[model samples]
Target chain A: MNRLYHYPLSPFSRKVRLSLAEKRIEVELVEERFWEQDADFLRRNPAGKVPVLKMGNRLMAESSAICEYLEETHPTPSLLPSDADGRYEVRRLVAWFDDKFNSEVTNKLMGERVFRKIMGTGYPDSANVKAGSKAIKYHLDYMHWLLDQRRWLAGNELSLADFAAAAHLSCLDYVSDVDWNRSVIVKDWYAKIKSRPAFRSILADQISGFPQPSHYSDLDF
Target chain B: MNRLYHYPLSPFSRKVRLSLAEKRIEVELVEERFWEQDADFLRRNPAGKVPVLKMGNRLMAESSAICEYLEETHPTPSLLPSDADGRYEVRRLVAWFDDKFNSEVTNKLMGERVFRKIMGTGYPDSANVKAGSKAIKYHLDYMHWLLDQRRWLAGNELSLADFAAAAHLSCLDYVSDVDWNRSVIVKDWYAKIKSRPAFRSILADQISGFPQPSHYSDLDF
Candidate 1:
């Protein structure tokens, strides 16, 4: 059976999970505290990161790569667009969320607020938390603007870009970091994505100590 | 005509440049001080980073995305493997270099040693430089181990993975931060990749304040 080694709050892992569910590919989910850097986990993925997928004999690391691999092999219900330009836009936004938005917001807010406590690192850095809080508003505004222009994050088609973004935003929502009322359009966009069958597992995700917010799993939320 | 807004020492810029040259795509190179976050550059890429590619009317950001676009549009000298699994490996290694190796090595060393002075970001952090220097050895060893198995960074065939690895390493090489003598196998691998026609522009790169090291352009090095 296909297996996914992931953490409940890891946006990267969540991105892959959304893709897998959207494609209807069943995979056994195994929780891994990747930061501990266990030798066995290192053997599975030298990168020592989560969302390591084991498909029969093949073991894959890197969320974006894994997503692309799934797209290439599965091809059904494609997460990427058919055209090159469309594909570029999708990948670009994926990088934006996973790289830029992630570092500026997710890593700051969630990394400090949730990850630090869970990983036994230390208390949340107030400075980082403040910056993340400020940065998130701009991100929400940006998303609002995009949702206003297009139906989905990248375009009319719901691409991996949406999954990439929703992955990060959902993680923050788990810790009650996102302000749903900040942008009506952005909120509407999230509400639409969150209602998808693919998002069920994510809504069901229960991180220890940090219980899911009442609204996190609500379809009407 | 196609144009690329880039900076000499930016690995992300170098990666796209290499792919463009390899694909023989003629493009006007425009040096963009992206950190300054010019309003026009922001309009081009809201992410506010370097290596933005303009292909006719379509403007593109993100190095890997640009490379993939180039591969799809111009498949003559293909940068990706034909097989799904092979392509996955190439992308995995590309992420390993562009994301993992980049933050751990390239960004740390270059961000401190070269960019700090060029961007006028104050003095290099001795701690980050020290950590980057220490981390690169393990990376080189890892590369050596990989090279011991496959002919190229990802596999037997040359792909974007090679360009991605070389792009970051070349940026560090510019600052004279890479210890090329650390691993003979890795050194041999670099020598081979460094000799490619696609590498001409990278080898010729010279930052204004910091002249290219004597060995940077030397094929025999």
Candidate 2:
């Protein structure tokens, strides 16, 4: 069986899990405290990041690359659009979330509130938390602006963009960092994606130090 | 004709330029001081990053996404491999260079030594430069290890992975940061890539403040 070595709170790992579940690919989930730098895990992935998929003879790292591999290997319910332009939009948004939003928001809020505690790094820097809080409002507004024009984050159809976004937002929501009431359209967008069967595994994720909020798994939320 | 909004020093932008040149796509280069956050550049790309490709009616951001777009729309001289596994390895290495290697090496050395002065940020941080210099030897050795086994960075064929690695190395080479004497195989690999016609524009790049080192444009060094 395929195995995905991932951390529960890692948005990148969650992105891969959502893609796998969305595609109905069967994989045993193995939680990895990747920062420990275990010799075995390092052997599995030299990059030393999570969401490393062990499939048959191949060990894959890099969430985007692994996601693309899944897309190519299993083309049943395609996450990418048919046209080049549409696919570009999807990949662009994926980068936006994984790179830009990640550095500004997720690394700020989650890195401060959750990771420091879990990893035993140090105390949470309230400054970064404040910045992350402020930054998230902007991101939420951006999402609202996007959702106002299109059905999903990228376009009319659900794409990897949606999964990439939902992955981050859901993790933030797990810690109650997200203000769901910020925008009705964004909330509605979340409602649509959150209720999907692919979200079940993520919703059930239990991190040792951090407890999930009640509304996180709520379809009505 | 297409146009690319790029900063000469940005590895991401350089990566796109290489893909365009290799694929024989005609794109007018527009140098963007993206960090200034100009309203017009932001309008072109909300992310406010360089190497925004204006192709026909569409304006695109994110270099990796743009490269994939170019590859998809123009597939003749494919930078990506044919098989799914080969393609995955290519993307993985591309991400490796762009993400891990970038944060560890490129951003540290180039960001401190070059961008700080150019952007008027402050004096170069010696600690970071030291760390970057130290990290680069390991990266070159890793490259040497890979090249010893395979012809190119990713595999037997030239790939976007090569372009990605070259883009970062070239920028570092501009500041005389790359120790070519460290690895003969890696130096040979650079020699082969540096001699390509696609590298001409990159070779000719003249940043406002930083003069190009003699070795930067040299096909034989």
Candidate 3:
């Protein structure tokens, strides 16, 4: 059987999980503390990161690459648009969340508040938390602008862009870092995506030491 | 006419530039000081990053997205493999260079040595430079291992993966951060890639404050 080695709160791992679920591809999920940099894990993925998918003899590392590979191999219920222009928009938004949003909001808030404690790094840095808090509002507003313009993050059809964004936002939400009241449109978008069957496993995710936030799994929330 | 707003020392920009050139797409290059975050540049890319491409009416941001779009639109002299597994390896290595290598090596060394002075951030942090310098040896070794197995970084065929790795290495090479002497196989790979006609503009690049290294433009080197 195919297996996925992932961390509960890792947005990149979560992105791949959403893709796998949306495609209805069954895979055994194994929790991995990637930061510890175990030799076995390093052998599986030299990058020493989470969300390594083992399909048959193939082991894949990068989340975006894995997602695109999935799309190429299993084209059913396509997570990308048909046209090149549409695909470009989807990929652009995916990078925005995975790269920019990740560095600005997720890394600061989650990195300090959750991972530091979990990894035994140290106490949370309040300055990074403050900056992350301020940065998220702008991101929410930007999401509101996009959601206002289209039904989904990239376009009318729900795509990997939505998954990419929801992955990060959901992780932040797990730590109660996201403000649902910031933008109604953005909140509505999250609620819509959060209710999907694909999101069930994510909602059920439990990270030890930090109990899941009450609203994190709430569909109505 | 197509136009690209880019920065000379930006690896992301160079990746896109290499793709455009390889695909034989004619584009006017416009140097954008994205760090300044000009209202106009931010309007082009809200992520406030370099390497924004304008092709006719469509404005594109994100290097990987733009490169993929270019591959799809211009299939002649393709930059990606024809098969799914081949494509997966290429994308994986592309991410390996663009994300992992950028964070571990490029951002630390180039960000400290060149960008700090150019952006007026502060003096170079010796700690980061030391870390980057140390980290690059392992990266070069990794490249040697990969090159020993396959003719190119990803496979026998040339792909965007080569461009992505070269883009970062070239940027670091600008500041003479790369120790080309560390790995002969990796050096051979660079020499082969550097000799490509598509690399002409990059080899000709001359940063105002930092003179191009004597060996930078020399194909024989």
Q: List iRMS (one decimal) for every candidate.
A: 0.6, 0.3, 0.4
Query: Stretches of candidate 1 above 4 Å error?
Result: none
Tens digits of per-residue lDDT for model 3, A1-221? 99999999999999999999999999999999999999999999999998999999999999999999999999989999999999999999999999999999999999999999989999999999999999999999999999999999999999999999999999999989888998989999999999999999999999889998789999988
Tell me the TM-score that candidate 2 gets on chain A alone.
0.99
Every candidate's DockQ is: 0.90, 0.95, 0.93
Q: Residue by residue across A47-92, what tens digits does model 2's lDDT show?
A: 8999899999899999999999999999879999999989999999
Clashing pairs in 3: none
Q: Tell me how far the alpha carbon of residue A144 in candidate 1 is from the true structure, in angstroms, after superposition.
A: 1.3
Candidate 1 clashing pairs, residues 3+ apart or interchain: none
Which prediction has more favorable lDDT, 1 or 3?
3
Model 2 chain A worst lDDT run, 10 consecutive residues:
A205-214
Q: What 10-residue stretch in candidate 1 chain A is worst by lDDT?
A: A211-220
How do all the candidates rank in terms of lDDT, highest first?
Answer: 3, 2, 1
Q: DockQ for the candidate 3 complex?
A: 0.93
* Candidate 2, residue B167: how far the Cα is off, in Å: 0.4
Candidate 2 residues lying further than 4 Å off, grouped into runs, are: none
Output the lDDT of residue B121, model 1. Answer: 83
- Model 3 ranges off by over 4 Å: none
The residue pairs that clash in candidate 2, if any, are none
